[model samples]
Target: MGQPGDQFADLRTDYERHLRSERRLSDHTVRAYSGDVESLLAHLESSGISDLSEAGLPELRSWLARQQTAGSARASVQRRAAAVRVFWSWAYETGRVPRDVASGLKSPKKQRRLPATVDQGAAAAMLDGALARAEESGGPVGCRDVAILETLYATGIRVSELCGLDLTDLDADRQVLRVFGKGSKERSVPIGGPAYRAVRRWLDEGRGLLAGPRSGTAIFLGERGGRIDPRVVRRIVHRALGLTEGAPDLGPHGLRHAMATHLLEGGADLRSVQEMLGHSSLATTQIYTHVTTDRLKRAFEQAHPRA
Candidate 1:
């Protein structure tokens, strides 16, 4: 080609195309993977390895070791490693490389930190604050805010799933939401009366005010009347929590954790919770069980008099 770097650039473009067209990854994911692979290619060049076919696990490990030396978080290193492994997998499968050195690569073990969540009382207070603000403002925006908080706390869907919702996604009669989660996997999440009423009020009294000509059937719209952005949803959660006194600082995902933990404590089975939250594996849902168990242990330790 024109230069040694040109081949790397071309391969990077092709890899991005493969991630988007064949892997069915989201644009955000595709971009992240592309950036990681680009970094790997740069490392390869620095190592005087002009050809990717000549690259081996040693080169890959050195690239990751440099990230560690640079103080990259373990999670970041893990994700980068995964990106490289997939990249080489693709390279070998496509005949760009005779062998996949990345096949032998391993990511750092992920640290399983307990997800932070508000207590039930804090969640109630947060929702109450949202509703009070709606009442005081007497505006469509306030109504929308109330609906957003209520829906997130009640259904425990991801911010993206909440933003992706259309009016048709709501089963108003049955009080359930048709949520498309990660990988476009659809799951039906039941809504309690508080969440249902909040959504109904927004649909009736709020969304019309924000509807622009470009606004489609999306259930939630931004101030510009376009489908709501996930960032906006996060801001809504953050701002609501900020107003709620004594509540922990958390985003939309915190609400998901709170919902799961509260359900587990309320006697909901793991399988039911798993299905509601759209977790593909029961093990992923089991973390909440640990949360509940720890709480129970604390209570026992506090109340029991015997050693």
Candidate 2:
């Protein structure tokens, strides 16, 4: 068995590879885990913990306490703790440590922050403004922009998922879109009538105008006719929101949040919303229920006879 000090890098490398190959984590997630483990190793070095076998729960807790004292957010602390646990588990399995010291280590409980979701009227106005700007430009790019916003809002898909979509992913006749989500999980999400119309318009008019000989099977294309980048989608969403009055300046996720919030507000079931949003866990979907409750409370205060 290799000594703990000598195996830190090897363990980290293997852990990262495991995350990529076995867990199928996205690049962003792999980077986050890598950063967390690196931060822990740096802390261990400063703390003089030279051997993996020498580490224990007290050392792990102490590190977490220091993080708390340094004002780390609960979410970050939780993630760091999770990373440490994964690292120790890998180390133990690979004989770098006699046992997993990080076993049963509790992470700081995170208070979930409710995401900001725009109201239906504001959402409509924002989409309208985006479409108007696209029309005013009177170009293929503008039409494509309008289509992108419509698809995002309509399907409640992540920007990355939307950008990864191909032309065959859309079943226009069935009003469904095949979305590849986190961990490359695929789900069929529905698109509404308005979004369908917008997408059809883009395909017929805008795409043909922008597409060149090199254009591939991507449903959304850039001016040069290759696949559209996620960064461009973010920029388009940011600019579109800026043109709206009093609308919250959120990225594409805001539109997704808006869609879930509005759906729940309009009597959609929680499980159905969860599936539509492609959330693997119902817990993640429950946050929107709280948003719905807050809205209900406000409505009751304004209109109930008891008040």
Candidate 3:
């Protein structure tokens, strides 16, 4: 091995490559992991420890403690700690470190914040608002907006997955969408008739008007007619939801949460939902259980006479 600093730099590169080529992590995940490792390396440098291999649990705990002292949110600190643990675990397995120094490091259990969701009535009104707006414009963009809102509620796909959709991804005959989710995992999610109608209208009547010379086979397009950006999807959702009186000012993810909660409440099984949402772990899908539980508690309190 060269100097500790050089070893750290070289190992970091290898780790990133491992994340990308071997682990097949998405760009966002890769960046997040790289950022956490960089922060740890910086911390190690400050303590005159150039080699990451020489660092151990005390240093890891100190770094976490410093993050807490600096007022990082518990959620953020937790993720950072997870990132570090994953990194050290990889290092040990690959022989960069003698052992997994971060194996015992534990992040505080994250507070399970219930996702915000509009009740059925509000959701219906929101969809109605989207349809009304579409009729008023009578144009492709309006059709696209209606489709965007409807598909988000109908399928519960991530904004990235929605924006990433191409012409071939929609199966109108079957009323299903081919969704490539995080880590590029693919799943087919069914689309309700209303959403399917809106998408069909957009494809048939609206997309042509917006298509430019640079336009490709993208299902959703920007003003310049290229593939839509996720930020634009967020803005569209916010604007569409804003049109509905008494509705929460939520973006696409809010719609996703609503879809998941509604599905669970309507008797959709956990395993099916896990497949539809493309969740890698059942635990991630279980958050919607809390949403349903809260709803049940409210319903019982409203109707039951035990009080």
Candidate 4:
């Protein structure tokens, strides 16, 4: 009965709950979608629209145009458009709107941006530095850092997945990790000997030094002995990469990209790599194949005898 802006508070709360409970989206994802909807509703209120039911394709287009004029990235605009479409679809189905105003809306095509990765030499140097620190310091933090870097490059898991790991998730006898990925999907990723040994060292000596009453079942612990935060993991990765000369500054995701590209270059099959990386789509895994191909082309151009 009130203005559309006034209705937003309760509706947004319900929508956020739906995303978290019904859709099983991660906290980060729920925040992004909710933020996009907030932007749209704010735009509608500024346009003097008192009721959401009155919004149409024109209003949607104008909002998108304003974002473009403001120089929003194409990918951000696309995601924002998708968020609006999903919100309106839900609204229509719930009998709040006569029809989905965003049903006809479309986003611009996503730009093709290749994932960034460190070269093999840089990755090796980083790992070596991590190991050197572990041995030189003989401290809990040093050993944990080595384990973290090894696990990240060896398994290609997300930072959240890494932080979420528990002691039971490590199948040490089998040399595999039980990884919980996006959307709560579970996958078992095999690890090499180095990663296994690094983890073992952390478990045997490092974790106990840092473990407090709050450590619980968490495999990785912060200085206070609580579950490690993803931000700390990112900082560790960035600092480790800094040890390698000429390596691009990258976070956990750069390790993921490097792992995938290195696997493809090593002749691993696409499906196997896909399963290891826990990607839902083959198309996503195929990007690493392109990365491998680009590297091969560069090598051929540099080394071939033909002028």
Candidate 5:
């Protein structure tokens, strides 16, 4: 058997390739999986298990225990646990180990915390303020920022999906956007009129100002004319929300939550909401229903005085 360090490095390369080429995971997910697996391998080496075949359920448990001791959040621990499970399962399937020991592994149940959201009025104020700011600045970058926020809220698409958009993805005539989501799954989502107008303004007055050879087919471009990074989008969203009082300090995902909650509260069916949000499962979309449920509970408590 090769030395533990040599074997682990080789295995991780193959594993990451499998994740990208076969599993078709996003770049973010692949990086996360790679980090988690690296941590586990380091734990095995420190525990004196020289081979993956010798690292069994007990070793896995020990690694998780160490994570807890190191003050890892529950969600972080859960994700890491899942990461190892996938890794060990692959190792066993590919004959790198004698058994799929991680198949029996488990992590803590996901906490049922509700995602944060702003009410419709706050959402309007945010977009309105963005528009006013864009107009006042009288520049293309400001115009682009307004369009980015509107598209996120109007369609509830993920930040990555938004960043991936190209000029061809916009269907102004159809009022839809051809979105490529996780695993490159494509879905068509309606574009609200305001969002469409904002995007058109950006394309007409903003995008051309920033586009360059590095921009490629990307609809949005950075200050340097490269594709806009998701981090920059988050920053723009954060700064906008941070300045708007009575609104939670949130980024793109918060706008997504607001979009879903507003749809549910406006009597949109769960299935339609699920499709709009590009959720793979209706169960995932059902969380927004809980937001409406909580509102009902508060109203009932305030109005009912028979007791």
Candidate 6:
């Protein structure tokens, strides 16, 4: 058996390679996994775990207990557990370890933190307010901003997917827009009429005015005519949220959550919402149901006569 230090380093290197080459994880994800594994290694070293076989269920549980005592959030604990599990599984599969000690380790029970989604009325008002402000600004950037916001809420697409969109991804007549989401998965989401109109205005007036000699086929263009960056999209959402009362200072995902929550509350089925959001698991989409239920309970308590 390899020494604990060498084994840890080899396991980390292999896991990172797996994430990059086989799992095709993004740089952000790769970095997170690396950091989580490193933290686990540091913990193991501090605990005097000098051999791979020395780690057992008790040790794993103790590590988790320590993390909880240290005030690590449940979500963070769960993620670290996942990282360890992946590492041990890879080690076992590759014969670097006799067996996987982390196989029986359970993650902390995470509380479901439902996203803060705007109500339908607030969402409409926010979109309308953005459009009105764009009109007042009377510039290409303003028009483009309006279109970006409208498209996000209309299609329920993630910001990264939206920014990666090309001109051909839009089908105005059918009101469908193709979005590539996490894991490089693609789905076609329906665009609302208002968003379609905003896009048309931007295409006819805004994009043309902004496009310079270096312009490409990107639907959203910067002032200098290159593809708009995700940071700019975030800034636009932040500024737009400031215009509305009671609106949470959420980024693009907040708009996505708002769209999903509103859809579920408006009678859309969970499976459909799941497909639209491109969530590989239905459990992820179910959070919106909890949001709806909470809202319903609040309405019932406020309006029903039973006390």
Using lDDT as the measure, the top candidate is 4
Candidate 4's residue-wise lDDT over 49-153, tens digit each?
Answer: 767898899999998988888899999999999999999998898888899879899989998678999999999999998899879987899999999999999
lDDT digits (tens) for residues 103-154 of candidate 3: 9998888987888887778789988988888898787888898889999999
Overall lDDT per candidate, in order of appearance: 0.91, 0.87, 0.88, 0.91, 0.90, 0.84
lDDT of 2 by residue, 215-288 (tens): 78888988788889899999999888888888888899999999999998889999999999999999999999
What lDDT is reached at residue 130 by model 4?
Answer: 85
- In order of appearance, the predictions have TM-scores of 0.96, 0.92, 0.94, 0.96, 0.94, 0.88
lDDT score for residue 218 of model 4: 96
Error of 3 at 1 (Å): 27
List candidate 3 stretches off by more than 4 Å: 1-7
| Candidate 1: tens digits of C-alpha lDDT, residues 211-284 | 99878999998999998889988999999999989899999999999999999999999999999999999989
Select the stronger candidate by lDDT from 1 and 5. Answer: 1
For residues 7-109, what per-residue lDDT tens digits would candidate 5 score against the true structure?
Answer: 6888999999999999999988999999998888888998887788888888899888888898988899999999999998899889999999998888887
Report how far residue 284 has shifted in candidate 3, in Å: 1.8
Scanning candidate 2 in windows of ten residues, the lowest lDDT window is 1-10
Cα TM-score of candidate 4: 0.96
lDDT of 5 at 200: 93
Every model's Cα RMSD, please?
A: 2.3, 3.0, 2.8, 2.2, 2.4, 3.2
Compare candidates 1 and 3 on lDDT and give the better one.
Answer: 1
Candidate 4 collision pairs:
none
lDDT of 6 by residue, 1-307 (tens): 1223675776678789998998887777889878876766666777888666676778777777787888989998998888788878877888877889898999878898988766777778788888888889899999999999999888789887887888999997898898888777889899889999999999999999989776677889888898888999999988888788878787888899989998988899999999998999999999889899998999999999992
Task: Provide the lDDT at 39 for model 4.
Answer: 83
